[model samples]
Target chain A: MCTTCGCGQGEGRIEGDEHPHVHEDGGGTVHSHAHAHDHAQGPGQRRMVQIERNLLEKNDAFAKINREQFVQKGIFVLNLVSSPGSGKTTLLTATIDRLKPRIPIAVIEGDQQTTHDADRIRATGVPAIQINTGKGCHLDAHMVGHAAERLNLPQDSVLMIENVGNLVCPSAFDLGEAHKVVILSVTEGEDKPLKYPDMFAAADVLLLNKVDLLPYLEFDVDKCLDFARRVNPRLKVIRTSATTGEGLEAWVEWIEVGAHSAKVIRGEALSSPPCRA
Target chain B: MSLMEGMLRIVEENARDQGFGHVRTVILEIGKLAGVEVEALRFAFEAVADGSIAEGAALQIEEPPGLGWCVECEKESPVESRYDPCPLCGKVPLNITGGTQMRVMALDVE
Candidate 1:
């Protein structure tokens, strides 16, 4: 029950204007979305049950299922996260253009409305599926699970999942991706890593995009790196410019290493027994 | 629909498992740094809880303070956000220890 135009008020249409209703778990998200408080309250005394369970447990459960699917299918999934207009879509297109032929690649794009990003990925001649979260601010594992199923990414292929542009909520939701790559443009505040520490801590890598504009802007690269390192000591930082393709090579190398490592791990798992997380 | 819906679904399933048809109150434990807006969650509950076990449930939110481990001070500090400098050392990026929780801690059910 997610509406595209109006925020989460109703379900949204899919890519084309023709066929809509591609929401995840619409079949039974809640078997009783139409549940009205019609049941009689017959001496129902309130009692407390200490559930002590995270609200994202359901999403994490779906994420585990997604992780298993990725492992079994040997697909390398990368969740791209960033603030809006951080040049996430541009980076995805550039990455796709560089790596699509070398290794089979497919993209799952998330946005509030329209098929713009998905259409851009498709322009590079790769399968791109757009998931409109409608009023949802982030892409949860449940949605990604269904999106992956629909994309049907090939074995040993790279699956880039561009999360909805928001550094806040996306950090908490795991989409079963091998890694969460967070992009921060130089134009944005250099202290974002500190400001949004959860996102920095959750991210596996930080892409400092729009580095070409660094010369013009007062963005302090060193400070940003220091802040990122402070938040996550192990976070790998990469500077990139999708327009000039300056740091795309190093980014490509990083992707290749990640994809290869994911494949190898999947291979090892296949050779041995699967380890349940 | 992603988070709150999932939560209500679990609550309903729990109600079925425990034979409680009605939820009187939902005491949600949300950390200050949990990145969730309680107001939005309440809105989601209003939208998705209709006819479910939690339809008429009262939402009681418990916001626990954020806990963080400071490296320089080598101590745990109460942090409201990651941006908050270490309470002890005044250093940024304290490892979050608490207050990032987004869970159903306790539910007053019938």
Candidate 2:
């Protein structure tokens, strides 16, 4: 007899039990016992529990925690995504030189193999860490975790993570960045956004680099901008040429604004949100 | 049939060695650009698990989104292929970020 639900023996007991149970009611008592005959077993009688959990949920959770940590530290972190030789290193060097006197900056460079980019950043007098993702197409939260621990970033500095040069894998794994900046150079065609919509759609800012080479190349700024807009209507596009320092001031200004806003938001003094407002 | 049966036999022996009476469920993470065919994996699972502890176990597959990072812009973009350019930057030679991974993230057992 089960005390809890007060249900009958047949209702409470599961099948294939050998012990017999007696149930008492107002009318009389009923008894049941396990049978000796073999039960008809199906081919696949094992039971399975269906769980609906996203594989990336673990990574996203880590990213959120990192984001909160960045907020607490009052540091603005940007994840820079672009192809190799698109001039990310050059742009970073220039940006660091331009912004160092006013705002302190740090960089975490990811590549398949090389301290070359980090060396370049170090030349600009900024602390940088080179993470070589050998044979791996992307950098995960674990790598970012290690980088954060190794970099010892300042409380108020802007930290940029230069992910491995691949347009596909890094976007799925978030390293807890405040902004995702996509760099498009003039040498690359205008249909890039259409070809890789996912990356464009995920970026907060779209940077059109190598604008100084615009006159020399066949790259159409308007077509590229239009395609990027078509993929991501809210993406902010900034044109820059690291070679001639063209449009770099505007880029620096944008970074400064982002740094200020990040500080305000982290301090809980900003009434409006950083991304939306 | 022989090849599938041999695979199934190996699975049964492995399950028995592992002391699993019956497998409840199996979960797999397949990347979108990982070059793995979902149908092929499913077929293999069915064939190999036919007479093993995983015989009736439910197979669950999850595909996480793909992403790529642009080295030039220092930005990470979501992507679907190795040949796709940076979405934000429109530049080739992108650092591939995600979507080519295969792993068993979880399993349900008795």
Candidate 3:
């Protein structure tokens, strides 16, 4: 399976690439070195070159650039991740309704295919851009960088990136956000944390959504929280329900605190002189 | 697929920098806690690297065991899963200290 999408190994086509195929090596070597000359020096003709670079080094570099830009602009960015139908959009719209009066906000909505979520966000009177991943599952740092550039996100504002609806893929890709918020609804199984440990482990906050429906369900809240904590000890959880407007205050306040910190960082950066080494 | 493409891009970049025409093998150091599925990576690499400089290149993965520092036992223990508690004390969450490596350690090029 592809870690980014959970698609079948030999089935799905990755972005900008065709299906896996073998090609004939038709003697394309341009070198004219004598094989016997190096044969005495090594056992094989292949030379070992050490790189010692991280696999995500390229993505991390892009993410670092995005992070620096966000910090400089005092933008508090949150990468919202969750399974589909976890009320991410509903919660986001509700949260925006509350925060928009006080703070400037922008959104980047990612989906496999749709301008619908972005349209919904725009309906809330905020700037939003939709990134259709096509066959891709998660939004990578490169895509986020391009989207951020296009959005021209304002300073001292909250930037919400609603990632592609998948509990698996988004956990590995960091989009230079200040935090990764994972939302799990009550309709889902409580053992989700244990089943998808990577997503729970990667998240800083877990929004236990659809708490309003808890009365009609057999979902164990304590067990769910415990399971999430077992995967990630410091994961802050907020019981939220967009329909009932429950826990919206705490969630909004949490965003405010983060946004305030970003503004403070910007203030400090403005006051300090650039250091030269 | 993204990871495989990233690895191929790195290889291509290094090929240009180091003056290598073809890659024979790509060595990776993948930790047990790196969240990478090796089988998936291997499957994706064939497609991602096809017709590229690393086409037909062999993937060699070196898996390192996950290590966690148990606060209750005041010792480090090998942990297979992240949710596992202190193997020694059987209580409290163990602080993950190792086995998150996901690096392209080396390459065999010609």
Candidate 4:
């Protein structure tokens, strides 16, 4: 009999008093000191099996790969993050229109459910891909990976990823962009950076959108800038109004400079930044 | 967020792959700066786990505080969120060392 399977003890092993035993009446009687070994092994195995950390490690690794790929391609990618109705789409549309006929641009639009922003970008005659995330509040590396496959972006083009209109979830996932451009409209509130600091903290550039509405609304621009700076002192802040095309030229110039810098860093070209936009 | 939900599904699949009949408890490790709400995740787990192996599982969440290394300050500082400035020296551009995570660490099964 196999002792390991609790069958009759092996022929060489007698049903001996050497082993610890538990009675059927729920009372246990230890016959040997070796029983302590079994007690220690159980907790030891548990400690070895338990792992702590985000299971999204795989996604993060993929994001790093995507970032390297983007850098190698010399494409300047910007991840636009903001809340719903924050003028992100409008700003992109205005920027695209201002920079068109000079800068080769493309867009990857992420939304919970809609092709609306993609349609708006397409109207500018630039190639665009609409990623409807369904119920997903954020765009992960996997989704961006799929979008990259579909876009087939030019080696020198500017790729702007308009993340899902969410301040929280989108900030957590890296889409392999060179910069995180966070858009906060004055209509949202001055304390937005403090309320959702992660988004502001992750931002490489902060755009104060819808500044044209500042006069009519009670939104304080200086307070918002001060708060944003406190959260991230190194953050670059740009104020713009998509409606009046205010500050758009500087925005376009910024992208052109970034693209040129990326190209030069990659040894692609010594070409000057586009001057038309 | 659905990312967290998808992560939980993967955990369930992994449990099933191990021949688990049901998952009674799940130990989840979520970083402080992962931008996930523990209570909201628990509610989402309850809703998403319905009819699955995790249907009745109790969600145990562990949140580790965020840690950042400020290049400007040249030291490590503990932070509550990603936005918190360096404690020793108020500065921007702190490199995040840890606490931006979301994962299922362990499970209890019968």
The prediction achieving the highest TM-score against the true structure is 3
Question: Candidate 4, residues A13-47: lDDT per residue as tens digits?
Answer: 11121421211111010011111111211111222
The residue-by-residue lDDT of candidate 1 on A1-277, one tens digit each, is: 3331121322544453354444443321212233434444465666777787777776687688889889887788999999999999999899888897688998888887778889888999999888887766778776677667778788888999999899988898888999999999998999998788889889989999999998798888998898888778789888899999988989988888878887887888889965655
Whole-model lDDT per candidate: 0.79, 0.67, 0.82, 0.72
lDDT of 1 by residue, B48-73 (tens): 77876688888899999988888888
If the candidates were sorted by their TM-score against the true structure, best first, what order would they fall in?
3, 1, 4, 2
Task: Give all candidate RMSDs, comma-separated.
Answer: 4.6, 18.1, 8.0, 16.5
Range of the 10 consecutive residues with the lowest summed lDDT in candidate 1 chain A: A1-10
Report the lDDT tens digits of candidate 4 across residue range B5-43.
554546655554454456677888888877777888887
Q: Give the DockQ (2 decimals) of all models.
A: 0.48, 0.06, 0.40, 0.19
Ranking by DockQ: 1, 3, 4, 2
Candidate 3: stretches off by over 4 Å: A1-45, A275-277
Name the regions of candidate 4 deviating beyond 4 angstroms.
Answer: A1-48, A268-277, B9-22, B51-53, B67-99
Give a tens-digit lDDT track for model 3, residues A1-277. Answer: 2232122223221222344111111111011111222212222356999998877776687688789889999999999999999989999999999999999999988887768999999999999988767667887775677577778899899999999999987888889999999999999999999888889988999999999999999999999999999889999999999999999999999999999999999999989985454
TM-score of 4: 0.75
lDDT of 2 by residue, A154-247 (tens): 7777998888776765666677998889998888878888777667767899889998888889888888887877656678988888889988
TM-score to true structure, per model: 0.86, 0.64, 0.87, 0.75
Query: Which stretches of model 1 miss by more than 4 angstroms?
Result: A1-42, A274-277, B70-75, B83-92
Query: By DockQ, who's the top model here?
Result: 1
Q: Give the DockQ (C-alpha) for candidate 3.
A: 0.40
Give per-residue lDDT, candidate 1, residue B97: 88
